[model samples]
Target: MPSDKFDVLVIGAGLAGLRCARVLAAAGRDVQVWEAADEVGGRIRTRAIDGFLCDRGFQVLNPAYPELKRAIDISDLRLQPFGAGVAVRRQSGSAVWVHPLREPARVPSMLAHGGVRPAGVLALLRWSLPALRPRALKSSQRQDRSLREGLDRQGVRGELRRVIDQFLAGVVLDDTGATSNAFALLLARVFLLGVPALPSDGMRSLPRQLAAPLGDRIVLQRSALHVESDADGWQVHSPDGVVHATHVVVATDPAAAAALTDVATPPAHGVVTDWWATDQMPPGPAMLWIDSRTDKPGPVINTAVISAAAPTYAPRGHHLIAATALLAPTATPPPEDATRQHAADILGADGRSWTLLTRDVIPEALPAQLPPLRVRQSVRLAAGLWCCGDHRDTASIQGALVSGRRTGEAILRSPARI
Candidate 1:
């Protein structure tokens, strides 16, 4: 027996779920959103603690997402741009590749420091060109392979290999050997062309902005336990009540999505982010810092004095610094002291004066996107059941938003539903 009825019952209030419901409801279809958490935004959230804003992870928005412009207003986010290029920190020295453009002013400094090289400069530009080409997006008819193999084919070795692997490990949150070549190329295509921006309100605002118009349509703190298809449509079991609907959408994390659809879910990677507050800002352009040196302390990858990139993250007189390290499946993360030390070494900041904030460990942070990647997945799971999520598509914000939009459109396209 069911308590309420709707044309579509959406489970999970994450980016995908919200986007799906937004389309369905806009089309005059009866849509209801159920979220287990007290608030929406799922993995993309912002928390206010001690007068500081901490995002779920070090996240920036990509406006080049084909659907983003249609989904939400970019101006409302009040984006903050990252510096022209990233600062690569190595054991011997550090250098900025200046991804934005070559400047006459920077040439003298680069040459004087002896940090920039002709070979490395050539390698960076050479690989970036492929991202702009059409073939980068096309899936190969050949055998699937890892990013390491792809780099080898491009004749990338030594410094270039190490640099790409470390930078990408921060992006994919997985080791290079476990990452897919096709996926890596696609990522390169997305990033090389896209401008990264952080919302002034916070990362959570992106989803919150999406969920805003659907006032009464959303039900929070209602954990949907199971989904059972009936002769008529579908019954979603929840502790609050079972809702009957013609279409059921499961937009939860990989484990929950796997349980509902019986679809095999990919392995997830755990990431540890350590936060530190300091009145003293690190000296540098507002840019991301990555370790270009050999690994010494655990799997430290990148650190950002995020406040320098986006001032809204910190209080009026203070700043926020986040240091991220990827964890192996069965490996324990390094202690906070060691982690702070590692971050200081990479950031060239005084760790002793900084105060430690909370440390967050998201076990299922990102789904492992290995070889043979599909940019999109079929939304129609059954006659009345559907699915959409980062796991179904690319493990990314754009993929999640696109998947939700596709599911919504697919449902509307079904003749019986209309």
Candidate 2:
């Protein structure tokens, strides 16, 4: 309710914004967060419907996410790992099974089943070599090649390219030609380091946990209109009112950030729709399914049934499956019936007995540009203005947290704060 007197004001209550507020508030700064949605957790959202816990998409946190380990109490949540293994069903009616690379014996079986192609295995080896580890870069010289270009340079071929492309589509929700190689490699490193796990409850709980300590410091259902700076400090204008603070952090998706400040460019992509089902599907390990040969230009990268790995997601004897597709710039949300049919067809669940439980189309969810590890400008663009988001670093939950923390640290180090 105050007009202009807080230490910091953060926009967008997504993981990035919440994390920023948490760190600043914990440090004894007067911090406040404004979320356009009635609730926190931006893209990381979950809903409970008809005895099923459904998420906006199939999202999981890698055990190796440094920001998660450092910023939140992982022990407080129930974590479920990927099922025994992952399987990829080809259009030719054959299936490929993929297991964690740590299990050498399983690797043979995976290769034999065509789970991974020979070229993919070789490319993985080449890319995974210690000598190829990512290095720090100056903002001006950071590489911006697409994932496709990176794979091609690594000599990925034939069946292996199809499999790898599909998997990347499912994970990144963008065509390889559109995704940044640097970002893809960063994600690969995270996956290679540990198993991916989901919270037993849902992904939204992660943000809720981060917002717990901030308590009443967070403001929900408030849309930030603009942010401006004067000689004294920064002002954040929201639909409810205006808040002037010593520092302002635009912790939103790239487009939203550009709208609020004078940023020259923002990531381009937007909106993602996901559908969830309960009960009636066959039993199997959770897998990321990439339909490479689909009639569509890009593959339909969706998580097949994951309830097996985390039964707590649904009631006993019920399974939870989710499929997500990115919306094109000119596209609108598909009709409910059409989306349902599309889910069944893509998931290969024609005769299965599953019931459609929840479907959500998040308009303007993810930014378009494949996120760049380093932004052209430092976190502090102005004396009292900062920016942070997945578009600045990695695109996963980990990136948001790390960016937020870095922004907080930058604010603390600034002479303006002192």
CA lDDT of each prediction against the hidden true structure: 0.80, 0.69
Q: How accurate is candidate 2 locally (lDDT)?
A: 0.69
lDDT of 2 by residue, 49-75 (tens): 877778876677777776789989998
RMSD of each: 2.3, 3.2
Alpha-carbon error at 139 in model 1, in Å? 3.2
lDDT, model 1, position 187: 77
TM-score of each: 0.93, 0.87
Error of 1 at 238 (Å): 0.8
Residue 308's C-alpha lDDT in candidate 2?
69
Clash pairs, model 2 backbone: 4-244, 97-115, 268-368, 268-369, 269-368
Best by TM-score: 1
Model 2 TM-score, all chains together: 0.87
The parts of candidate 1 lying over 4 Å away from their true place are 1-3, 101-116, 134-136, 141-144, 295-298, 416-418
